[model samples]
Target: MGVMNELIDPPGIGTLTRILTESAPMVEWKQTAATASLLGDLNLRARTDLVADALVADISTGPVPGYTTASASFRAALAAPKFTGWVLWPVSEAAVTLALASDAAEDFNDCLALLAELTPRLTGEFAVRRLLARDMDRALAAILTWTAHPDEHVRRLASEGTRPYLPWAVRVPALVRRPEATLPILTALYRDPSEYVRRSVANHLNDLARHAPDAVVDTARHWLAAADRNTGWVVRHGLRTLIKKGHPGALALFGFPPASVAVSGPRLDQEILTVPGELTFAFEISNTGTRDVRLAVDYLIHYRKANGSQSAKVFKISTLTLAPGESRSISKRHAFRQMTTRVHHPGLHALELQINGAAHGRTEFVLEMA
Candidate 1:
């Protein structure tokens, strides 16, 4: 199995079963073991399903009063040594699913309480999604309070959980329509001392940028006014998509002035390449106008796909300021190695240079199989 698969594979299930059994000694170990064994024949989705199944089996057979009581019992059992970090992901997810199944508001409250302790172990981000769907106002109010919590993980959950487009989780339509609802949470944590929290805030803002560009640009301007190094980093990172698209407002906010530059010397070191080969290219940019100019330089490679089509992927080269009459040379070497993520087919590939989002220089090269 690959490194990623190992995290949720059989060993991970075994560890979770052992911890659960130890945490709640009253749990039916025999039933839990049987459920775990059944997980081996299942794929990823089946494995997660089995985790919930095992939790249900344990709860039914073990001494449990209700969902809230069961939640508390399981949580109490998950003390130190056994449950911690990414290794506990399967267990955490199972617990969250079980908690969400409860119909009682009190049960959800209990789950939220458990998540505060469990989030640092894995993440309560996914768990909170159900709460938001259940009651947006209530969930947002609680999450807003969490933003101020002493624990950076809880603070991060406040932002991460409310993301309009959180990956691997269902989209929050309310947030998608009214992203401003999250501004208060973002405002509280934009300059958070923890890089972990700040990164989440940046990502949250990036997600908002997708549907609410104007709002995001406004926020960027507001944040940039008194940005410390860390806050500035968040603003820049948050504006990555806008930067790539060469949004004039975003560029202007970053002081990347209008295009008063000239680009030349678009050439490839080789016209033909084989698998596992290296392609070297160089270009130069000069500030022809009588003023300093901030520039965002990037290059795109149109890779040949197996189905005789091309897809372009952009890569950043540099971001800099150039004085009047100043020129700079940029060079890059890209490997054409076979990657599991992408299949490279032999064909003519196009290379283009983008300055402030406009394609200025172009070249082509041939890629062949070894």
Candidate 2:
């Protein structure tokens, strides 16, 4: 990615300079058209408003490399007092949109803050989020007030704006790392009168679920019990993966009944491998008796460590709706990579499969570490 020259400069002037430089080349056409539109306006404020409107109209234009089109046009447009108020609003929106389309550079951060100031005036909630996604702290500060704003649009931004992995916006890894701070914000908006705002709250809660499953599950359960169909939809969408894979707490939240399950060793029913490297396992489940049943089958791996202790982590292997006579098989591969899980010491590793809430089967294999 090419760095913007003004990106490295100090905040205020640097941002303005970069905007000017990037927009200078296209200034002639944008400003000329704007000025032409305001030819009959004698009042200064009205003239500025017209210019501001013009800038917004042409904001989607390109940077043209060395050309300073947008920056110059903005300069000419901002000259009118009428355009000033309009200036920040449109410019903020345009800048936020632009930032999402590019990587986070110093210029991007500068643009984000500049745009955030005008958030109170802008009607788009998503725009505020795109800007906030750059810096979690700044985003939290600006939006905390917006949550109380009378405008539903602004209020929604309070929740929608701080989503950890909001689509099209830069992902805020910090927020993802420490999701507790986000709880109050989500709680305030989860039951918002406006469905739009409430939907955002649900999504925010869901985002937190990836790292903090317990929190997400708890919050979602509280919301789903009293939520309407639309609200329920929002909660379900957010919890889709967790529910589909039959997360224990998630299954319980959805009122799924427990069913008996059976899992066999790797490669017996399907292909299997013993790993110092990688392995594959085939898990099968059947409804032995009657009664319609919805069940969740999960697996946990116990890695043997040099210290002779075992470390275990759980993963959802499958969810099934079994009828009077139904059986299903799922094949999964386990890679002994440093990323997913750590293999402490080479020894006999144990695997346990949990059905509903009980451990139903076990398998063991030797892992040799070189």
Candidate 3:
């Protein structure tokens, strides 16, 4: 994410300004003023908005509506050969911002079409989110048709743009609340020939599992009923979140039915995990059930939160099948590295094993700040 922010750095904006100047006759976009205040760690969204704000401000200066003026300016900018890549992110954003200002169905629909055009250059996923928020039903109606569109990028946008929990994109409350809103789109593209499109569809379905597990499972089941060579892969990816959370239906979908098992120690190399150190742990599980049982094995880490509370996070370990009386040893080495996403605090912690949607043994350990 940090590296992506650098893609639209100061020099990149200069290039954007140069392209705008050379591309469109009416686009006299001077990004000089916009670049001045963009000092420091102005995250990716901030950089995109800064540039879009400049475009909207410049193009809408005349009597024309911002949407009308900006849309035309951006459409003209597209004629340039180099008018692609990360620069289009702001352009797509600016187009949507202005189009929504008109509040006319014509402009809103045009904005959707514009995003379809721009998606091939760089994803208009970030920009189209606001449109979905504004008029979900109307936008989704248009997006549904995109699932069958010949262009792979447009098909991908149909699924990717409507994800309920699309990361780095603004939340659409209606979509999150009514998770079924985008199922038709997902259903259509689940078996898409393009891996890119299929990936987005799986992720879109996975997002649904976060809030609407039953619906997600049902959808996966429906897809599985009409199975293809790629259906299993798509369903597996779609159920990833549910699988990680040890959801029974998800585990069952992959034929990992619950079974009786005897678990041994999750013994650690050291009882105390020092900062900038490694923790190696191993455990063994035996299939005590009479029939062979498939397992989805995972490990859980209960880390001490900053406020002295503990939060359990699950990590994927491995998956296997064991016959009755069969046993297997699971071992892993976890590094306690300082990361931007998680801040580690020193205190009591624990490790546990999760097999077949059930947690087995837990071993306590201490975290020390070195």
Candidate 4:
């Protein structure tokens, strides 16, 4: 029954007070105070149902400005509870965004239309991703559409929002288990006109590289072959994991390769002391190149932990500039104790020689029981 003040929060509450007093002279002060109190309670813990009911009532009775604030506050409140479990909320972009942000992980699903339209402008892309994480099939479908959205923000969200292990969001096992499923989405964004979107794509691909190095390497290869200037850097960035693991495709992309491989000894005396156990390495390095070249030679050891899983640790025991026809023998004593480093069980441990930047040769050695 009165004019509404459209003020952004941190609102000038006093302005609303004056507007309410003057616009609705017949309106009781108590009612106005109640409205103000409801607005203020946004920062507190309140019941989701109660807040939703109050907001719906406000939206139905008040002017548009009041309706907007009430809706936003109500959605914010709902986000704290099981909003995702109840999928029947009056779907507005604001309410949908908030519901996605909720910690509730029951039967919630996103409306594709709203998701396509709103995902770009939504502030908390990571929060929205949590809801999607529960349903990869749905999330991928919606993200595919959003990837082509005209808005850069929305396009960016299509990639950033779908990380395999996005923080605070539900972990999408599909991405981690089978990163290949994400290739379609990544492919679409690879050549996107928007650098922002492309960068997100690169990061997403890199995320995939953690679990699926081959998949990322393939994608990077295609991008690099095309030599698309817009996405060249993105391809490079996306290859980080593969490069780190000494994948040949990745190293070759950068025009570098290891020319030799050799090993020194199987002696136990030179082993380094590890509290729980000690590690000994015998390596033979060879220079296959004709020119004398400097190389960063080291071995990567994968040790088993108490939990029966393996972890990789790198040791840089030697670096040398070798003659074109020279060979060298090297031994490294790696000691380990406690569970701090990778645990070595009674199983075979993986060993690899990294020559220059390439993984030259790989072998398995038994980790004898102590």
**lDDT by candidate, in order shown:** 0.77, 0.59, 0.86, 0.57
lDDT of 2 by residue, 1-370 (tens): 1232222122422243344445454533344253443435234334334444445445544445211333335445444333332234335455555555554355555444444344454433444655555566766765576667676766766776677887755466677788877877876666677887877787777788888888888878777767765666767777776665456787777766566555454342223334445676776677776776787767777778778777766777766788876877777766775444454566777777777766656777676655
Question: How displaced is residue 129 in candidate 3, in Å?
Answer: 1.1
State which candidate has the highest TM-score: 3
- lDDT winner between candidates 2 and 3: 3
Q: Residue 285 lDDT in model 4?
A: 66
Cα-based lDDT at residue 141, candidate 2: 62
lDDT of prediction 3: 0.86
Inter-residue clash pairs, candidate 1: none
Q: In model 4, which runs have C-alpha deviations exceeding 4 angstroms?
A: 1-94, 97-124, 127-142, 191-196, 230-232, 256-269, 272-284, 288-298, 307-310, 315-352, 356-370
lDDT of 4 by residue, 1-370 (tens): 0112122121333333343344443322243234444544342112223333433444445444332343333334333322232111222323444444445442144333444444433433544454556567876776788777778877777787777866545476667887888788888888888887887887888888888887787788787777677777888788866666666667666654555545443344432333456566665666666777666666677776667787876656555777877887777766654463344466656766676566645666566655
Q: Write the per-residue lDDT of candidate 1 for residues 38-76, one digit (tens) a residue.
A: 655455544655665666666756666346545655576
Q: What TM-score does candidate 4 reach?
A: 0.56
* TM-score of each model, in listed order: 0.73, 0.47, 0.81, 0.56
Ranking by TM-score: 3, 1, 4, 2
TM-score of 2: 0.47
